[model samples]
Target: MRLHEYQAKSVFADAGIPTPDATLASSVDEVVEAAEDIGYPVAVKAQVHVGGRGKAGGIKLAESRDEAEQVADEILGMDLKGYHVDRVLVEEAVDFVNELYVGVTMDRGEGKPVAMVSTKGGVDIESVAEETPDAIAREHIDPAFGMHPYQARKVVYDAGVPRELARDVASVLQTMYQLWDDRDASEVEINPLMVTDDDEIIAADAVMNIDDDALFRQQELAEMEEETFEDDLERKASEYGFDYVRLSGNVGIIGNGAGLVMTTLDLVDYYGGEPANFLDIGGGAKAERVANALDMVFSDENVDAVVFNIFGGITRGDEVAKGINSALEQFDEIPKPVVVRLAGTNAEEGREILNDELVTVEETLEDAVQRTVEYSEEEAQ
Candidate 1:
């Protein structure tokens, strides 16, 4: 679950991290009042879950009440990356000389949590990593032994942080680590941690994502999942109780396992086709479950064609085929063409049972993916 900037900042401030004083407002009047109370030169920021807010005109500086009203009126009720903005954060602007980045996340390859610090901040860290890999310093922490103060100090030093502020930066890094550990968070980040001319450090932005599995024990964080859904498709996927993720593309993908679904997505990309969604029906899915999955995918306006990639193990190929046939029959007219690639148990029987008019069966995954891409492209044209 991803937390909005205001929520993340609130959590950070409670954990003793220094943050610029900010007020949450849901209207232009509230923003003007907050700006007046917090003094001039405030920032009116859209409270949305997506990034690139500043680039999208979702963030602006307000030096006076008139400016605050203008910014708030423009940002509120605007669509930012498909998310509707209903609130804004009025924050006291900071005057800083330098910006830095600090974050902690799991390094799946290393099987440990990694702490990273970079002097090149206030920008996309991924871009910095790709262009100048040496600019970011990393330290992997073992689960047996949590991150130590020394490790934090070393990371800042290696990142070329100024000596006079290294201690304070290390302290903030340590606190962030503690928060990540105690809250069962998957990631914690502070971009553009500001260094003032007076030698004081303050966090200018916050981005935290909690582990979904760990939310069972973290009740407080679990309650913060209200506005995380990007659209109605996501909310419907949740209601349907399947593993579904919406993506930007025209090909709708469905498989029986997580690995199979991910592989299908990759193959679609390799074939120069964009996948609109990833829907894993899991092991031993019944006809109704498959129908539900199809319904969810077909609801997405971006999906131009559908692909069913099933390598039956515990999942029966014949059952999957029957589900596809049943789901298609429900439509008054075929919503879109479907491509099915079936392997493993009952593969031949499954292929024979499919409705050829609605679905084209391919014996190989590569053939199936390529055909699906072509189908989507044809639909687009």
Candidate 2:
């Protein structure tokens, strides 16, 4: 549920946060028109979900309408980290004397929302942290009380921003916190928050990621879903009712729960393997769900081996076995070898049923992961 930069900026503007005037363009002509409307010296930014756009040359400065059209032509069809850039944000460029970073995100360890601020901006915060950890200031806000004005003021001042702009920045932080909390967002960030020569503060960039679980409450936000860039496998997986996240590794992982899926991925890494994707079939692992999960994992060409680790408590092991068989029947060819580890309720019966199948079954989780890793390595060789 990550919003594009333009979408996030729209939310920010609605929250009374000052930001650059921007227009969404889906074509070169639209971009030129937007630049003409915004009046020159605009920034044409690729509206992709991933980061490092600037490093990838996805962000270009256009000094005039003609330059805007040329840059848009070059960027519109360009690929950024495997995602095709179909749209660009044409925004009025501004001159600023200072840059800062402000963001609010959930802290799972603290079970609260934390506000992160730094005077150093317009660059990757991770680089700043690795080079100068002290440059970033973090303050956790109590969920019960929310982010008070005084707390935000303290965070802003601690970041070493000038005294004149501290209050303005603090106010923007408070607004961002409110927007994040009200919208049930996982993150709300304003990178390179700028202060012009006139001492006016504005948000130069906005990025927001909403909590998918809370989408039921925000129907308006839910309707804004855009599938223009999603791959065929991802769309199909969503239609089949499985939580799937595509990754870059060679091992495909499927489990009954998120915790188990994550643990299985870690184990794969521990066994010297990389997980290609995270596919969670949820707590109720019916045959259809299991089949859907398997189909999705096998759909990935990067998967050299598949691992199904299920500790069936709420989900029965036999049902999962049936799903695997169903998936095998549905697909003419499975791309990789599969390893299964079934434990808990009716595990023995499931193992007996899958014994005649082509899948390799292991009695222990570690053994299953080790075998998958070995199989992947052997296949690669």
Candidate 3:
């Protein structure tokens, strides 16, 4: 969903946007090699997901091979905002007279894509906004008609872009908009869009985040995603077709829908219990699916107790109960205490069918959560 700088720039170049010539390197030797190839005065920047890389000393300037090697050695393997930097981009340092910021992202309040331009660049846009809100100009673009050229120019001019560079900036903004639309991107940005005295524009920094749900259609873009997942359970969750997120809490939660799962998590927190994970079985989940969900939750060592909150609509409570029973049968001994709260269609029958000896069935969500939290707290002691 989020891209490292080098990866984002690759997307930028693919869209015909001009960027500083750069090379990706995974080692100090490779960094020096890239610097040599790009010719001196290159910028060595660590590739990480979070912002403030510059502030974290993740970025450095190297005018020679020795400096490049030194910079590379210092950056590679360094942690930037909790992300380990394994790669660095060695880019040709642009001789620029001006810097600007250009970005396109959804303004949820307006329910439209917002194209933004600011004369203040190479700095945190948020700080600029807080300090001088008027320095940034925004234009709301309709998804139906897309970004018009006039609107782009107006935004650029309002950002106080000099007359000579207004057209070029506008062109870049349109290209960015086109890229956002064409790639199913939730956001695209070019910070410090450097403008040279030679009347040339280049993207000095790139940031793009594609919509996770849209990855299905954007095959090529999706392929560009980092091949490695930091979380093994998350990788397994994807394979198992479960809407899941791992958490640090001891009480594992399973529900039929996203909203229900979220509420269950909130309740776990409110009851003074930490939620170990978020697992949504989705509507109409069968016995087998429920069994699979149970297996997944039990696999987590962090989970001390599990709670099943089912408000059946399309999801039949009987099926869910059957799944819980079948899944518990697979274990020679139950891995953790499990609490179930069944409501709506066939809930009473589902409750009756459940193995009372194996799981605790509660009448209300609060009772189920409270009982599960107690189990987890007992485990902690």
Candidate 4:
């Protein structure tokens, strides 16, 4: 689960990481009041789950009450990457001489926690990584030993952090690591760890993502799930026993496993089509689970066509067909076309069962993807 900037900052502050004074506001009046209380030269930042807020004009500096109110009013209802900004964080602006980046994240490939420090901050770290990989320094921590103070120190120093502020930066890294460890977080990042003229370091912006599996042990973090869902469809899908991720495309994708779903997405893209969402029903999904997956996929209006690419190994093809039929019966009318490709166990029987006017069944996976994309393109016109 991804935390909003203010929420992440709150977590950081609790872990003894310094952050600028900030107040959450939902209205122009609240923004003005918060700005007044926090003093002038404040930042009016739109609170959205997505990034690139500044590029979208979701962030602005307001040195006065009138300016603060204006900026807040402008950003409060603006859309940033499809998220409607309902709140703005009014923070006290501080004088800073340099910006740096510090973060700790899980490295699944290495199977360890990696602490990364970069001198190039206040910008997209991905861009920095792609353009100048050497600018960032990394230290991988073993689960048995965990991250040490010296390891954090080495990362910052190697990243070219000022000598005088090395210890402070290392301390912040340690605190960030602690938060990540304590909360069972997948990622904890402090972008633009500001180095003020007075030699004080503060986290200007923070972002964190907690591991969903670990939420069982984290009561407080589990409670934070209320703000995680972007829409009712996603929330409803979570209630079911499937994984769903909404994407901006016309073809809805449903597969039995994560790898299959991902491969389907790649094939769709390769064939000049875009996937609307990623829905994994998991292996050995029953008819009810398949029905739920179909319901969730059709809930998305953008999905012009849906492709069910199931390589039935442990997941029986006939059961998947029954679920599709059930879902079709539930809907009053076929809102969009559905393409199904059932291979492996009982494939022929599954194809026979799905020989209905409601869907088109294909013998090959590539054929199914192509037909789905073609149907979606035809639907567009």
Best by TM-score: 1
Candidate 1 pairs with clashing backbones: none
Q: State which candidate, 2 or 3, has the greater lDDT.
A: 3
The numbered model that scores best in lDDT is: 3
Give candidate 3's error at residue 263 in angstroms. Answer: 9.3
TM-score of each: 0.86, 0.82, 0.66, 0.82
- Candidates 1 and 4 compared by TM-score, better number: 1
**Each model's backbone clash number:** 0, 0, 0, 0
lDDT tens per residue, model 3, 1-381 = 877788888888987889989999999999999999999999999876667788889999999989998999999988664456788889999999989999999999999999999999999998998999999999999999999999999999999999999998999999999999998899999999999998889999999989999999999878878542234566667887999877767899999889999999999999999998899988999999999899888878778999999998898889999999999998888989999999999999899999999999998999999999999999888
Q: On residues 77-163, what C-alpha lDDT tens digit does candidate 4 reach at each position?
A: 886655667888999997899999999998899989999999999999999999999999999997677788889889989999989
The list of candidate 4 runs beyond 4 A from truth reads 77-79, 227-229, 247-251, 265-276, 283-292, 298-306, 313-315, 322-339, 352-362, 366-381
lDDT of 1 by residue, 31-108 (tens): 999999999999999887666789888999999988999999999998775567888999999999999999999999
Tens digits of per-residue lDDT for model 2 on 100-210?
A: 999999989998899989999889987998999899888899989999998999999889988999989999999999988999999999889988999998888898989
TM-score of 2: 0.82
Model 1 weakest lDDT span, ten residues long: 226-235
Angstrom error at residue 107, model 3: 1.8
